[model samples]
Target: MTITPLHFVGVSALLFGIGLLVVLTRRNAIGVLMGIELMLNAVNVQLVTFDRVYGPERLDGQLFSLFVITVAAAEAVVGLALILAVYRSRGTVAVDDLHELRG
Candidate 1:
């Protein structure tokens, strides 16, 4: 009935793999952003798991996870805003089409 670090690690690995696949296969900018978010979440899961395993006895894992969630929220907002601007300017959200930025 106890959750182990190994369990959390396995879940994190699965999420990382799925996120990698999404990044590799999707061409839409939004899809890529989602993949990046997924990967970040996976990293957060690992960090919290480690903190729980070895940190002081004050539930630091949950605290760090909260900070990560906050940062992720800000990142998502900024990233979506940028994506919206690009879509408005370029009329497309495809990753391949973003090369127009190259000078």
Candidate 2:
């Protein structure tokens, strides 16, 4: 009864799938950003799992995961800022309400 890397991979896959679904189905920009964050977290989990299972001597996997985390943070900040700006201008955050680009 021990945890394994395979279990982490399976969970990561499930999270990625759910994240993808959320990104695809949600009309709100914030919801889509949340999905993207979930997907990024799944990737971080896989990176850490693989590092623990195979690359204990090297910190490459963990380092990469940290980089991903940093990027995800940056993305969330910038994305939320943009969403806020849009909402302020349009009065709604619905994706469908953003029809100013119809050309």
Candidate 3:
């Protein structure tokens, strides 16, 4: 069977849902970050699929995906750094234990 745009959208929605579930259920900082990445990738997939359907001659979707990747990479770096620092100081990466930072 040949794949269609609907297939891509279905897969993207599934991926986004999985990522949202992970983000909501995960306690570890790294796990949450991973979930965010998954969500971002899902969005990228949707962008590309729509671009293909609407205007295959343009590179807008690919360009936007690339920008998202760059932002995601930077976010990962900063998030990891914060997580590392918190783990070093607090001895845990659990979200519940981070309330100590609250004023």
The best candidate by lDDT is 3
Which 10 successive residues of model 2 have the least lDDT summed?
94-103
Query: Given candidate 2, what's the lDDT at residue 85?
Result: 96
Ranking by lDDT: 3, 2, 1
Model 2 per-residue lDDT tens digits across residues 1-103: 8888899999999999999999999999899999999999999999999998875689889999999999999999999999999988888888878887776
**In candidate 1, what are the lDDT values of residues 24-88, reduced to their tens digit?**
99999889889988988998999888987897687777788888889989998999999999989
Task: Look at candidate 3 and tell me the lDDT of residue 51.
Answer: 84
Better-scoring candidate (lDDT), 2 or 3: 3
Give the per-residue lDDT digits (tens) of candidate 3, residues 30-98: 999999999999999999998898786898988999999999999999999999999999899999787
Which residues of candidate 3, in runs, are more than 4 Å off?
101-103
Candidate 2: segments with Cα more than 4 A from true spot = none
lDDT of 1: 0.89
TM-score result, candidate 1: 0.83
